[model samples]
Target: MISTRKKLLAASIAALLSQAGMNSLQAQEVIDEMVVTTVRMSEPLLVETDPRKPRQPLPAHDGADFLKTIPGFSVIRKGGADGDPVFRGMAGSRLSLQVDGESVLGGCGHRMDPPTAYIFPEAFESIQVIKGPQSVQHGPGNAAGVVKFERNRTRVTEPTVAIHTSALGASFGRHDEVLDASYKTPEFTVRAIGTNAAQNNYKDGDGTEVHSNYQRWSTQLSAAWTPTDTQFYEITAGRSDGEAAYADRGMDGSLFEREHYGFKGSIDNVSTLVSNIEFQYYYQYIDHVMDNYSLRTRPAGVTERAMNPDRETRGGKFAVTLQPFAGLTWVMGMDAQGNKHSDRSSMNMAMTDYRNLLRKRDAEFSQTGAFTEVSWDYNTTQTLSAGVRADRWSAKDHRSMVMLTHMMTLPNPTTGMKRDDTLTSAFVRLESQLGDMPGTVYVGVGHNERFPDYWELISKESAATTSAFNSTDPEKLTQLDAGYIYNRGNLRGSFSVFYNEIKDYILIDSAFRKPAAMMGMTRVATIARNVDARSWGAEADFTYGFADNWRAELTLASVRGENKTDNRTLAQLPPLEARLGVHYDNQTWSFGTLLRAIGSQDRVDIGRGNIAGQDFSATNSANVLSINAGWKPAARWMVTAGVDNALDKTYAEHISRAGTDVAGYTQIARVNEPGRTLWMKAQFTF
Candidate 1:
């Protein structure tokens, strides 16, 4: 029965592989360990692209599941806890998610708590990704890129404790569970995390059952205070809840509330050999709710039709850094946010009558910002970094049916009319390293200005959504990025390319026209507009280490999005994909297998639809496979198992959501990718 969360996840992977062998025995005993010399050193912190590496933990089912094993990254599935992350071709809010840098927007605007569900990569140690817009100090609508999840600070010289666990089973009725804990004291330190997941109702590959089930959980706590070694302080708090059901939306998200708290502190300089300075502050909160009795069927077997929506958001950011000399460095920042939304509906039958059928409402939003950056190094082989940012945003709707909502009157392209405006942005970059070419070369250019949310402005219907989609005007983008990196000595590589040009680009047309309500009345329509677009992409990541525990990895990505008026494509761009892996570890055991290949797009954009759309190029071509293993006996405890897909392939991924009868059309042309699954895990350390 090994329950109790698999005996506390095998005592937390036998105490993180005995703390990864006590971090290789404190790199020869932690004597002084007070190394803090700040600032300016862009790109060069890839904890593990390979180097005593052992990476492997992707066979995901949620949170865009293991980020599609990185590359350009892609995911838009609907039947497994909200999936959405299409970088390269871009996705929602131009992709920007941070944990240590605030901003984590996602509460189902048909999204359901995305933003990697507030992360839990075993209580993070690091996971940073920055693609386009080249970094403006993390925050303020990051033009199609940026991902950060960092939780560092743990170096026990005295007290210590740790734990982790896992259990998984897949195929239709899937299940998952995880738990994490940490504690280290010389002064103080603590951490805790928990997670749970479930799945059922699955059938694709010609057989349909699709209805996607779900359940979720999260909890976190952190505290740190180091009286010396320079100085330090930290505080964190968290809470999360979940529920899901949808066969392509009609309503269901039941209640996915999340509330988080934060605080941080730092200081450095022990024997000043040069100048230094640093400071930071952060905060967050989010709450959401949705309904239709969780899923929906209402026609005769009514469950008293229901609908209730709610949202509340708050954000923060602050930063400063300086090194003043020795090759120079500097950084400065500021950020702010606020939001609110509310809605209600009911017709008694299961929610117990309350004034027959009621509808409630609320809305508001705000943003503020300031930024700066600089970095230089002429010796150690040339280095440079540059940046800029400026922002001020606002919004309000005060409620009215929100008024046949649709931005308060006229036109429907799908829901996104414009009017609201106020934004500013800028960027720059350059990098080089040539001791006779072995790696490193880069360039960047950026310009962005955006302001429009709350469904691009009251779910649109036009007065341009009350003079607010563009809030009167605010939407622009111009970008270019280039890259190359290499290393030998066990091999490591990178390649990147990107291009974007968008001006007033806003389009949504999910089948226009609809107005019928009386059998318990409820009709709210939408249509949106604005156009001009272009997108381009390329990505590659590599790693190799053949021996002393074998290893190999390769990832490739491609993207294309267009709509230069009547150019085509662009309906969730994210096709061409690839992933490969082979790993093995010693001194106990660890094994792996990961391979994913996807290709096949049918091309569309017949002048933006009208019986000429819906070809998706007959979508086809998908391969996925996985296998894993881990075990550690003494030194604390650990265990892990595997088997995923392993020969049960039938693909579907186009941002997910399909299956509207015709025998459910193979659940949306068969896009269920979970068939031969199984899993096991355990861990603990103290």
Candidate 2:
């Protein structure tokens, strides 16, 4: 039956492509499709191919799952899912993720959500990835990088509605479903989206059933009122819930819930010399529960092993845009947020006996800032752009917990402290046309300042070394960014280089006495001090269209990290990576193949060894291959099929489930990448 289906689909695609007159072509590579544009910049830019959106349907899993297609981008391979994004050797808090305009801090001290899991990628219209410290408007501590997911209001001239649905059946009982729709009219517009997905525990290509089963769902409804041409109003509300199994951590995320509400209005087409003015307010609440035996039952007598944490945030921003001259624009905004976090644990899943271990921990952070960008167009040959921003931010942290009528001594000068931070950043870019090649030559430079978050400042521990919490400070980072872009009618590419230095680099030293003192943990009595360090890397992306129906994309990247104190390789720096892909697309059919290669890395920091490092010297690399084909059976409908990891490669990623201690052998324990797998999908638009 499967063979028949494949043949039918292939024939349909070929027919469509042939009818579209796309038959004659040379061999070319296929790349992911992603368009990147920021609110601060006038033009749009594309991240590397890997950093771009995958060409295939997103797994409908989580935010991170949608990002794996880009080159130089890899995740710590745990078991089934929740693989965190690791970019050029940086992971964890080093990389920051924002949804809409808010941050969803993960509950696992080890970071389960990694921000990616908390977002529904299909719900957003665009995603922007900014490498290095080029922009500080999204909050501080982006020494590694920043990812922003955004959804823009949809506008259409006529009344219409659209719906899309797809499903997948694979080995290990994996299945998924998605439903999204939008309605538009002259006076009002409405949109709604929902999804349901589950997997009954998957087995490695070796046929080992990983206890990685999971189920998740989300729903959103939004409405906008544009009664007139000069003004508009919108209201949006959404809810998300899910749970995933965890093999690497002691606790599995048994319950995850998110609630979001927002309201905004804008004044436009005005005669007050104001280009645009907008007012907005947003509120979100997250409730997370993690337990050791929730998904996979634990042994008897295991009394207290779960963390129930709930976080709430309320914030609002008011922004204004002005265009005083023909080629200049300025955007200024002020925003403030208040948040509270509380945590409590118990022995059983049911609430039989409760303890007053935690009442409610409170924290507040606020920011006020102004930004402006000026651009000048010198005829059609040259253009220049410059921008700068300054901000004042303040935050407070406090914890008052009394357990069993016993008062635990808050570590260190537990007395809270406060500081006022002022940050300034700027950037410059110039572009000019190149002869008759239809290409543009460009150069850009930027700098930014960031402040430490409440968690990074106080959470501390040294599992390998004995370090007391006497001295620890916020991190300060500075980066130098440079890049050039070139484009022709059929070929395009860009290269970027970055150098970032930090003072008080957070180093994890487990060898010290009372190790477990190098981390961001509050309940545990440990210390994570700050040292100096440096990180630098280079990345390049290119795409070439050799023929009308064929094209290819190539990407290459590398990163190096050093601990200034001891001058050693930073643990878990991503290994060198390269990606090559080719795709052929015609009017009726499309086909593509992608090849990814990873280099061997042996850098080690025993004390800071994450899951994948315990056995391997942080060095394991392999080649992965994937192929796909799509056909248009008729107008408004399409069918697609593909195979992932065609070779069933058995390689362990530095942060994958392949790295573990299973049958007692000193196994590298890297979770096996999905073996040879096949999938088919069909879509119809109305």
Candidate 3:
């Protein structure tokens, strides 16, 4: 007899194929747009841009790099690539990141591979950023915001083939190759994508080489079947692998392997009351390995050590849209996700002992959620929108014992213990057009209750307990968001602000110490604790077209946080930053320059931060200049070249992790940014 999981999987695939036709018809109406040099607000609290388009400061190498180009975003650099993304002073699970309607998680205990690590920017069609907790449509626990990377399905009335390819070469032995090809017909469509990127160790402004080198590759295949104009179905599969050397940790990532599968479908005109229905299911698996001897030389007198961790995730979503009344629309949906994590390790490298050992299950998690959102056009110039969501979250501790050290072990206090919580989140917003002006304004308020994540529960210990699994409390947040967008003639700009008050906020303290033993020996331990916190910030951007084919743009962002429980500044917050750009563009050629300035940050709460890293010290101000140019030699071919960090300014971001000593690498106070670098890219479409 077929199992229930197998039956569900088969049904999902069949349904996806039946709905492929509707998505293909919609794709036929899209028009290819030009390259985007700068992204701007598309709607209140929303920003959208094409990920395939080339941008300044060199093309992105990963998802985190691309996000850093947006305002109110930062990266916690671990190496030359695979950095973790931070938005609005929040990291980890606070921000919801989805790719093609699927949530992919990392398998590293130290966050060497964030969700963005497996993402290749150029492989996606569009990237959408919904700032603040202004909507509850995606998933649960998105207290900060939501980011979605989507791919559009294409359908053709006649047999057609499309191909897009690009090559990039830059300083420090860096090179990349990307290819996207597709074949489409009235009956079916198939697409394939592949990417390869690698780089040698890069030097800081002082010409000192850092232990940051990496190589990565990925491939994906997708197919869609369209039976009719109102039905569409699709399936996708992909895999990726990579290795990265980090300067902030004792070990380097030797392997990052990922496998993913997805099925989706949509049906239009389902009924008179229900206008549309959509459903999707996805499965993802990650196998990660890290060691001290793979990328860097093992330190003398130190035993070679390696660790392998893996995670499996499965999830699905279903939704329906209804036109209940004139000028009013409603969308209702439900989603469910489950994940499991396991680990294996070895103290010796020569024997490859870890490969022969069985993986020990450490944690399991699951969540089921339902949501409804509504939009109403109150008048021609005014609109109202609201959404509410509830999620049932469950977690289980699978560890039988905890290891205080290689020689010390203790019985797990929460072994086989399961915890469950029902969390609620909601948001409401109102938007209105300025009278007699080409401008729009909006205001919103949101409340979110977020359950503790794996890192907070199983990875760290409590202040006095063996594990934080049962000690840390869920976080409750209330935030106010407001923004304005203005567009008139050749001038356009946007400004947004947010304020947040949090109760029982989860905080990580990396300096916690165990009591001294008989020999008066103290050991440091990282712990998780709950605290009250508040934060506020603002982001603004403006652009003006001056002389013909000339434009000037300015963008600014800053955020501040306070730990009310401790009466100190919140740790790991990014400092004030601004960017100014001048550009001249004609149909055939373009030239641009960017000036980036970051202000000094003095507020600090050292040894405390998020799961990824902690604040070491205050950071100093820095400024850098860069220039780029692009030329279209033919209708289907384009070339772009640029110089980043033109002034060779040696600097590191305030949120970066502190550097650790490593063999064959110079140790620094913090992982520094790349020095002066040159890069070039060529793209072709056929």
Clashes per prediction?
46, 47, 10
Using TM-score, rank the candidates from best to worst: 3, 2, 1
lDDT of each: 0.59, 0.61, 0.87
Better of 1 and 3 by TM-score: 3
Give the candidate number with the greatest TM-score: 3
State, as a TM-score between 0 and 1, how close model 1 is to the true structure: 0.31
TM-scores for the candidates:
0.31, 0.83, 0.94
| Worst ten in a row by lDDT for model 1 | 31-40
* lDDT: worst 10-residue window of model 3: 24-33
lDDT of 3 by residue, 1-686 (tens): 57988978867844543343223222111112233445677689998888776766664478888887788988999889988889998998888899998988899987899989989988998889899888888998888899899988756789899899999999988998999999988879899999999999999899989899999999999999987777889999999999999999999999999999999999888888888899999999999999988899998987788989999999999999998877788999999999999998887766667989999999999999999999898899988999999999999999998766545667888899999999999999999996644578899999988999888999888999779999999999999999988765456678999999999989999999876444777778889999999999999887766555667778999999999999999899999999998877664788788888998998889999998888889999999888888888898998888888899999999998889999877798999999998988899988
Per-residue CA lDDT of model 1 for 1-686, tens digit only, reads 66988968866844543443333222111111111000111253221111001123323444455555567766666565666666775666676777776676654454555777545444555556777766677777777777777766755678877665555565566676766777778788787877777676655544455666777777788788887765677788888777766565555676676777777776666333423333445445555556555455544544554445556666666666676677767777677777676656554545554335453444567787888877788678777777788877777664544435312333323222222445777777677775544567777788877665666565444433322333333557888887776654455557777788878666554444454334655343344455678788877766555555555667777888777875666666657877776766563776767777778766544223111012233466687777777777765665666665667666777545454432222335434654555656455544
Pairs that collide in candidate 3 are 16-233, 19-231, 19-232, 19-233, 20-232, 20-233, 21-226, 21-231, 21-232, 22-231
lDDT against true structure, model 3: 0.87
